[model samples]
Target chain A: MQKVFGRPKGLTEIPFHYCPGCTHGIIHRLIGEVLEELNIIEDTIGVAPVGCAGFSLDFFSCDFVGAAHGRAQAVATGIKRALPDRIVFTYQGDGDIAAIGTSHAIHVAARGEKITSIMVNNAIYGMTGGQMAPTTLTGQVTTTSPYGRDNGVAGFPLDLPKAIATFDGAVYVASVSVDSPKNILQAKKAIKKAFRVQQAGLGFALVSILSTCPTNWGMSPVDSLKWLQEKMIPVYQMGEIKVAEEVKGL
Target chain B: MSKVLLKGNEAIAEAAMRAGCKLFFGYPITPSTEIIEYLAKHLPEAGGTVLQAECEVAAINMCFGAAAAGARVMTASSSPGISLKQEGISYLAANELPVVIVNINRTGPGLGGLGPTQSDYFQSTRGGGHGDYRLIVLAPSKAQELYDLTMEAFDLADKYRNPVLILADGFLGQMMEPVLLKEKKEGNLPPKDWQTDGCKGRAKRKIASYFLVNELAEEACQRWQAKYDQIKEAEQRWESFYADDAEYLLVGYGTCGRIAKSVVLNARKQGMKLGLIRPITLWPFPVKAFTSHFDGIKGIVTVELNAGQMIEDVKLAVNCRVPVHLYKRQGGMLPHEREILKFVGQVFNLPVRGEA
Candidate 1:
């Protein structure tokens, strides 16, 4: 109770505009905490994709560049390449990253740019009003998939962290959820690892956090996090999928 | 200070290095790919940035990112690719960012042939992107000029706080010639204090075009137009040849200028009173010269690779002082020298040039 409850300095003093009990605030805090702890707030540059979190430029104290729709990976790659001495990362949502920007994310990793990515996997698109996200489970119901997503109709939900872990250019890959306090701690650790890996000059670190959207999911904050745990985690396991340090060869 | 037999592509690359261009974002397109490939191999070795972006849109956006960080960044593409990059170009212009772009034009309405052409003259010179904006466009004829123009391009871009286009043709990209690279010759044009280097100790700098209100955006556009007006006073450059006592003025830019140059020399040898007004900066369009030529010149013959883009501008500049004839050839190949001379002959109605 005495410690571990401090706020991140990387975030601005202004309150977030997200809805109450929305996990975006929690995830943003986790990333901000990592940036603050690493003392990278002043020099760290973030590429904010076009989504709900895309407005993060106004919230984060660090230098942030807003990318065009679904093009944050490419922007981050350019920013990191030009300012290789600084820490560069991107904050993207599932629709922004795994759906429209799948090619950019894959190619950015494949190119092995020394950058980190924080992909928020909320099974529905929040900013655009609860559309079926690329990570939407097969039987998930959203505004777009009102009858529950049929695999035959909408294709299978993409397992992003697992799919990205297979790429050889990725240095570290992990999936974490914000459903429980224990998982939040683990999520903090994963975000830290991504920043640390980028600091080490390793290539393309990604920490995919399973997030919640109360406003769009049409549920109370409690039910959304609970739904993510009961429904989303079975499709996306919350653990590290690939670790570069564990590989045998130098 | 390197003296190398460099092509236009290599010259721009070498000159960029001399100007401290450590970051390059480009997508591979014909004629312009050498600039991308050259940077790809060199930037990494020199502790710089080289990203072969996924598409022209992504590539220019990458340049936007790098330039936002105060990096001397550049991108190169052909006509069609430049079309794809138009939106980002407008954004960069709106944000008043310093970046260099090279368009090695091939014939194009769409995916036009890979052959060299000056068809993109209007695309590069005029505001191809949607905006009340202007880019300092340098049209280089020779490989050595490519080097000279590129070094100047960064300065012009920084001076205007805008993107500068090094508009070259495919022939210039491929043809080799001796180039003399310079170091810091522009005499410290300016430091990039306008860029966002995280604004460490200073007030945070915002690099964006987003405005919530239409009125605010319109005000920004007006401010941008003022910058353009100031740019015209400072950045207009052209090369005048045989302007003193010429009867006909042959006007062109990029590769067409070179062909027109040879034609000028040949016509001079034949004692035909012809002069070449080659616009080195295609954007400002040598309006002064275009207006001045009306006093004595019989006609202004405009040649281009495209159907008739720059000719319209030439006609506007002439303002009906003289007949502005459009001598255009589309497709990849250069207009036949004989065919052009025949048109020249018809202009004077003199013996029709070798039975044409």
Candidate 2:
């Protein structure tokens, strides 16, 4: 019981390289834990994205492959095709997934390529030093958006989870956050559901883990959590976007 | 075991499925569209997928998508369509995906005519797309070659986890010939040991192809190069006809290879010592076999449906002193054996092979 919330054996023992108070590590732990609980450590292959989360491959104990910027979905598609019996997924950050990888993700869903995508929405490019991201919220100030994400010039922030839900090909989708304990539990359940859909042969699945970027957001660990609760939650929301309940024996 | 008359294009699509292919994504193009049409009617029956994509670009990307899901996949197109697929082809190679593609070539730089052509010699054998990637390319001359080469392509692709291409010209795709099909095996390829099928009982898995660290991509590239050299050593394919102690030789592949064969046989009766060289593996080029004959021969004339494309290789193989001449036609099939026999007479200094 003590080890229930503990990390999965599939995750390596190495500490994360994430900046202080960043929820990327937390999201990683949750995903790893789910993999262990399911007992699929040996069969899992991870497609790492181009952001700081790109190295999520090294943190995971299982085999890994890295994808070009915004191309994790495409890479994941290939991997899944070649070995349809394995449980494949990708770990992508906001700038990597929603921006450059947007079209790929869209097409992946449209094709329903029987894989899972774990997208971490941190609102800024952490590795490149807080540049604007496609998911960067309005009024959010970053190194690139010094004027606080000017809607006039930078355009509107993308609603990723909702945007993806409209696709007919994706069988399961959700936008979960790391702000509260209740929300964290919900996020885990969402991640679990995404995997379950694939297990049930329900075609494409994706789970967007709404997270925080303390270093890039220019806030302390505590303040970052507070900001995530205050600003990001209402917008990103929490819940399963779609599910094939009938196929899953609901 | 079954043998049936099949066009090269149809043989390819059928052989792909018989080898455990589950998905085919392609757009229609001349010479190769028959492959798509066949897959559309057959794949669904095999519990596989077949989609006519919006464009060659979209078609190849769709192959990328199916590939990610851990499925055996392929796509077919001609020269122009292949040009559009180069980007996705690069991405597929970058990921080290096992994809099978069939390109029935037509003439080109711009919407080249639908007639047969081997102008894509460099593009198919040499790395056509960006990056340090080489697709294992097989050039098939007959419908039987198509059946056998496609099976080999899938096996090689899976063995190395890379893409394999079958380069046949319009002649192979549109022409009909007898093909003996192998026994259908249930589940021949290894299951996607790395695919994401959901982890209800065990753990999460991910499959992708990307290497960012310069040293890492380089290391992977080196690994791939080593694999290619090994394949080159083992699988370079060709056939020889009447070359044993011959005075002159004709060099070609696919349609040109067949055309050269007829002339070689006719040149035999005339007592002129002329042999033929047909390369089945375009990438490996069969350089040593084709060129070494020059040590004893007087001249080598390379014939093809393209203006002197393969002649370049012959010269490179035999060296400048060997007098590597070119016999070429453009956007059309090369004329029959008589046209070639006329040249054989001139090159070998023989009197018109007992009338044209």
Candidate 3:
């Protein structure tokens, strides 16, 4: 018998504490696989955000620094600037990146910081129960929006990847999903490329992953994936959003 | 190398560089803005990074990142800006990262003015941020002390794996005086085995403040308290001028301390029994300075640029052995020497000087 399948060396033995139906575990596995495949696990430093994403501090085998909510990019900026030779990345959720941390997100992209950021867009605040988030889709009901999110009152869900694509500093921007096996593989590819961009010292790179929150969405794990594929895939741009001339080579 | 004339803010920047600071993240604000400006111009030449962050909050978070990466880092701001950085500062304290923060304090309960004031004494000595944490606060009264204390702050920060704050007022920041740029001597600091640079030859490291389990959190708090206790024991610093054999003592820190020293000297020339006790470490509060010189003391007067904030600590230090009087000038106003002399004369029944 051959050992063809096992946990990635980049992940610790500690099991994840995510909700049963959550896609965070799958996303975590993808990142772990990417870190191992790149063979840069020993040379990379990661910054974890102040949400479910923050729990990554325990999962990744690479050196990690947990950042305050929405400030992961800022913290990553500090690390990368100080240790320019070491690869640095941030793991952040929609509420952590698109809400209170919005200013840091915009400025990090605008500054063309030589770092990678993975934005997991689940459209709701997961760790803090099902509350409304900036990425919450209009007409979507949440704990704070019992009457459903109204576009007139709550405004529209932010198209973060699209907005980030416009920044000249953001050399590589991709909107990926993990709703299917094929998309999961594609998400891993995009994540690896984001890290490659940093390894090359090209510029800022980001991969916004459309994720699922079954518990927060009030759906089963199976139905959550179905809803994400049906609704989210159509609303969000589904492929590489921006590839600067230099990033195109990578 | 040699004594050179420099503004307080500029001297602090130069001193930070000499102290092996490799990164500076700051936002430009009144009185303290020169610190960032000077570092932005000179730090790059020394192969250091100086970033003018979008705001104080971002700048301080950046300091958190660099410090965790084992880089000597600093950030500076004034009163309102420091308030903005409270969240990040709290995180830094919780994580026990080494960082030096400079607060060139301006008057404010809120954006009061840009003039010199020591109104931030409470915020600096007390943890400005949330949690049961403390920052070692160093108060420098003049340009020379500003340079010296800024250099020492980095060592103190690294020694304890905690944040150190240099607290000065707007007057000290803008005033020009001679500073001796002392040679840097390396302190025997513990190795940075906890830094998150990489895990190449070692196990992965995690720098986080979140302890989900209550027992783990409580243990962390106890560990930090032990470290703070050790600091309070070894780091109490103060200067006593003519305190020996004096009947009345005046107490102050930062710019007000310099003013109080002048008042003490002038009072002594007038044959009045006056003295000064200047606290250099405001957080440790230099209780030892008071108890050691308490004999034959009648009363203590606190001179400040705010509404008697440090007087509370002064009262605690003396333990109500003598009455503590407060002579303050608030809202960016400086306490005139003559007014302090008159107030002290009235309080202790001393003879009023000719100038008064």
- Per-residue C-alpha lDDT of model 1 across residues A189-212, encoded as one tens digit per residue: 889988888887878889999988
CAPRI classification of candidate 3: high
Model 2: lDDT of residue B127: 69
Query: Candidate 3: what is its chain A TM-score?
Result: 0.98
Candidate 2 local lDDT, B1-356, one digit each (tens): 87898988899988998988988878888879899999899989999877665467656765765665557899999998998788778877776678898889988779978788888888877767888878888888889888988987888777767788899888789888989998544435666665444444554454544556889878888987887788778777788888867778898889889889988888887777889888888776677676555567878888877777777767877767767777887876566788888976776677873464
Residues A47-123, model 2: lDDT tens digits = 78777887787788766766667766766665565567778788898888788768778877887878899888878
TM-score (2 decimals) of chain A in model 1: 0.95
Best of the candidates, lDDT = 3
User: Which pairs, if any, clash in model 3?
Assistant: none
Give the DockQ-based CAPRI class for model 2.
acceptable
The B-chain TM-score of model 3 reads: 0.98
Q: Order the numbered candidates by lDDT, best leading.
A: 3, 1, 2
Q: Evaluate all candidate structures by whole-model CA lDDT and list the values in order.
A: 0.82, 0.79, 0.92
**Which residue runs does candidate 3 get wrong by more than 4 Å?**
none
Give the Å error, residue B217, model 3.
0.9
Q: Pick the candidate with the highest DockQ.
A: 3
Better of 1 and 3 by TM-score: 3
